[model samples]
Target chain A: MTEPKVKDNDVVVPGEELASGMGYLPGQGTYRDGDKIRANRLGLVHIDGRAIKLVPLAGRYLPKSGDVIIGKVRDVTYSGWIIDTNSAYRAMLSLKDATNAYIRKGADLTKFYSFGDYVVVKIFNVTSQNLIDLSMKGPGLRKLEQGRVITVDPSKVPRIIGKEGSMVSMIKTQTNCRITVGQNGVIWISGEPKNEIMAEGVIRKIEREAHVPGLTDKIKKELEKTNKGEQ
Target chain B: MTYSKRLDGRGFEDIREMEAKVGVVKNADGSAMFRMGKTIAYAAVYGPKDLYPKFLQDPERGILRVNYNMMPFSGMGDRVRPGPSRRSREIGMVSKNALLPVINLTDFKNAVVDVFIELPQTDAGTRCAGICAASLALADAGITMRDLVASVSIGKIGDKLVVDLTYDEEAIKDMDVADIPVAVIPSTGEISLLQMDGIISKEEITEAIEMAKRACVKINKVQVDALKKKFEVKKNE
Candidate 1:
């Protein structure tokens, strides 16, 4: 029988024994050491069925393909744009992938997307050489306007968005704010200044408490308290 | 041997009072502050971001750079000059090497991780405390590592071997015999950094290493506890 050495939410350090035996499979944040699995980082242990994974509490974002991210246009070349994806790798968005419109040679690309403009885009490809390709042709992909952006731990983005976007949608409806969560941990919230600050606070709370069980319910209660205070 | 006793009235194998806290710096990716008795050191880690200057970028693995600085008022003496001295540079290099073995740099190709350790107050064994703080800071920054590095200083005072020499003992004029500092990855029982000063017999050196290894196991537990406390979940409030 497969047995887990650590229970869910147990804080584990590097080289700590995670599980033993052939029935268990090592997952992210874990590596097999002989007949036992060991944690490769400081994180919380997560046992899911036969797989044991560790969820890191800290670290920089590692960019992957097909992830929706928010980045600032760092430079605009003749054919493409260099975007800062908040990771070690910078992303490139060609004019063709950025939009469907046909463009003539020598067209001014700066007019379309200039320096320092934050855009919501999706990663189209990531090469073994760490080269990243991004595209703006997707639903809700556009330049961010009049929204204050805050960054959290990128790994906590999933918790902030919740299952099927329920958590974010609840925040939007309660505060009546437009919220965009980039997989890279960049969040843009636009609404009344008061509501925007409230939304930002709630998002930060989620990021800090991502490892806690029943976090969704806690955030809901927090939103209710703020709603009552606002009325 | 009559004057070799520690000022604090502790046993030869006892370490100084050690305390570690992570996420001390708000702006840093990861930060930790460690205190050993009266000595205090703070470390902050930044990046895994792009390597700059172009010439130093490694294609296969990330480069690790460590800067160890001691404030002019950190010790009880005529003020030291602020900035990197020859001594600080040597300490920084050894500290960097101690951490390099554990950090998985290949995962972050063409990037750099910078660790800055500041000695706000120091007695003896400051480098060991700095290493301890740097490891916690790296872990807090979420850098993947094979294991955590822990270090301690073991020295021979007259004929007795002692762990974690204090400032007064380190400064003792002609009385102290040998100062050995060792950094190790406890899980693998590998020594990443070792330094020996003064005179020690071959047999004594082996014994001192064994003593340092035992001390390391205790220090490693402290490091792990600090990391766990940083990420511990708080009750709903």
Candidate 2:
């Protein structure tokens, strides 16, 4: 009998293992001795077939239509508010979308989103000219209060967060700190001053050594050390 | 009248205390910061992205763009603009030309490879160090290319060529006019970047290039060592 082939863009559940990447399966994807398959794609793996099919994880953050992101209000324009989305392009959040309530024409825009205020917003539209239109209406999308923000390498966010939020969940459990890990490497940690410090330290340590192998062990060791000292 | 070598208790060709680091900036796609003695350089690579305009896009391969900037505090005496200057512009263009020969641009069609170099300190061999740092950063960013590029500046001073020159040495030495900065792909013995400043006899230029090539080969080992050490530390962590 012939082995089943996995198609591209196929969604698979986790723990299924990946059989091959898109197009053609590379020589390394196939196991020499058994039917086991190595993951070719970087996403959820489905093991429904005799072999495993790979489903890709969430793609990198592109300013998609109606997607919500927290933006830092940069410059206030006469007609709109310019936000730095931490992307290559700057987004404009007009006063019309700044709030659900009606905004008067030429009204004071600062009342909605003053400069440097972080606001959760949705991308209403993205133009070919790299112009991004934003709105401030969405669930769990609102202004962020006083919190310490730290940046990480965006590519390493997955590794930092770990599988199914296991890494961050462990950190929160250990430090007793409320942590928000933004997709764009921006993290906000808030809680008691002591827990906040511990969480920030752990995050920075991970940020510094995230590229290293055996990171899970390192994070586990760090949290254990912190726990011992706290106890 | 003066027959003795300078303080630091070293010969003219001796390199100063060298320390190199990779991946300093978190935001850059590829980043490295290296310092040799007091001279420091930070390089960032963000590219293989879509080209801006249709006319500027290359159908066959990616276009490499390099920007070199000397921060105002790079020097003790003169503060330069934060942006690119004439010298930096020329250096950037030359660097781009140098790297293009090593990078497989065709892999990234219709995209642009942009490299930005920031020199936080100024010395005689800033450009050469900048090139080396940028190469390492590119490698750290996982940009598959040809072998790593290594560069060094050798100057003729007091009728002898030195491997690396400090700011004071370059400024004070007016008698020897020839200065050659060469970049080599150490693995393949390929000459990707070569530039000479000041007047020198053809024989001296050839000698300098040959000497620089040998120095570049040694420098390549250090580059490999730095990258390997970085990964080794990561694996242990």
Can you write out model 1's per-residue Cα lDDT over B1-237, one digit (the tens) per residue?
555567789889999988999899989999999888888999999988988898898887889999999999998886879977899999999999999988888878888999999999988888999999999899888899878899999998887889999888887786756789899888778999899889989999899999999999999888888888776635333
Best by TM-score: 1
Per-candidate interface DockQ score: 0.68, 0.07
Alpha-carbon shift of residue B96 in model 2 (angstroms): 6.5
How do the residues A76-168 of candidate 2 rate in per-residue lDDT, one tens digit apiece?
Answer: 998789987765457898766766787777788788778898776778797644568987766666777886777665545667688898889
Could you tell me the lDDT of residue B106 within candidate 2?
57
Question: Which residue pairs of candidate 1 clash?
Answer: none
- Residue-by-residue lDDT tens digits, candidate 2, B112-163: 7678999888776788888888887776665545456778887776666677
- Candidate 1: deviation at residue A132, Å? 1.0
Q: Which ten residues in a row have the lowest lDDT in candidate 1 chain B?
A: B228-237
Instruction: Give a tens-digit lDDT track for model 1, residues A1-231.
Output: 865878988889887788889889989988887898888888888889899999887788888888999999999997899999898879999988998888889999888888988999999898765789999998999989897988888878988999999899989998889999999999999999999999999998888778777787878888898799868
List pairs with backbone clashes in candidate 2: A43-A57
